[model samples]
Target: MPTARAIDTSDRHPIRAFLDLRWGGPTIMLDGRAIDAAALPGFVALDADGAIAGLITLLDDALQSEIVTLDAVQAQAGLGTHLLELAAERARALGLGRLLTRTTNDNLDALRFYQLRGFRLHRLAAGAIDLEREADPAIPLLGRHGIPLHDEISLIRVLGAD
Candidate 1:
């Protein structure tokens, strides 16, 4: 299993390189807003070889922490879950009440993954992806399973006192 650690300034190069390779650059569109993943604070999971196996970036606010990006180089390896767990821990440490994330309508895997891990559907912003595409034309029309990526689904997991 890979070990997860908090992302620091020294990780900028690898993080940006990883995001650029996987997501076509660190700027990700969420809720029609452009967010620079490289600038956010989050966690990274490294394999035995000390190579980045997965990473997650978050935006912490007054009320909740939003998972801006979460990706594992290899699926079914528990890397995603580990990163998510760390994000929740960080949120709680910051005195935040909730952990929130958004996924596209076509990302059925994400919907299942988040829901299975205690997240509940909070909102459905119809046509939100369409608006986002206006800003980032690279937003694909079709996503996993060949489904049209059109809307945004928000998920939230409320933290209990720890």
Candidate 2:
């Protein structure tokens, strides 16, 4: 298996292209806009064949770092966990004491996965779905699980950094 490595911005076109497949319009404009390059950190895990199997992006914050995007193709194969571990490690290394993530209420799998990984349920933004819809009307109001997307569920995991 290939090891996790810091994503090289110079050679990051492939990574952006891959993420575009999943987030082009369905989720966010991860690749729709040109990157500023001076943005936050990013990383990826490669499989044996040098193909990116997982990707993650960290958004720096004064209080805690937000895990903006985490995608893994091989679910239940430890790819997600590996990426999470790396996030935690990077957070600690960067002096960030905690990590935060937000997902739509319709994402039950994400809810379950975060909880199972020691992320505590924090709070829910009641009008998140409406707000998102207002910002981007193209975003569907229904989730994959048939749940009406009305809010965002916030979760937090304290990193042992401080």
Candidate number with greatest TM-score = 1
Position 117, candidate 2: lDDT: 92
Model 2 per-residue lDDT tens digits across residues 1-162: 347887777546766666667667213422133333224476788888878788777777787877778888788888887888888888888888888987888899999999899899888888767876776798887887799988878899987732
Clashes of 1: 0
lDDT of 1 at 5: 94
Score every model by TM-score: 0.95, 0.86
Per-residue accuracy of model 1 over 1-162 as CA lDDT, tens digit each: 788999999999999999999989999876556789998999998989888999999998899999999999999889899899999999999999999999989889999999999999999999998888887788889988999989999999999863
| After superposition, candidate 2 runs with Cα above 4 Å error | 25-39
Find the candidate with the highest lDDT and give its number.
1
True-structure Cα RMSD, model 1: 1.2
lDDT of 1: 0.92
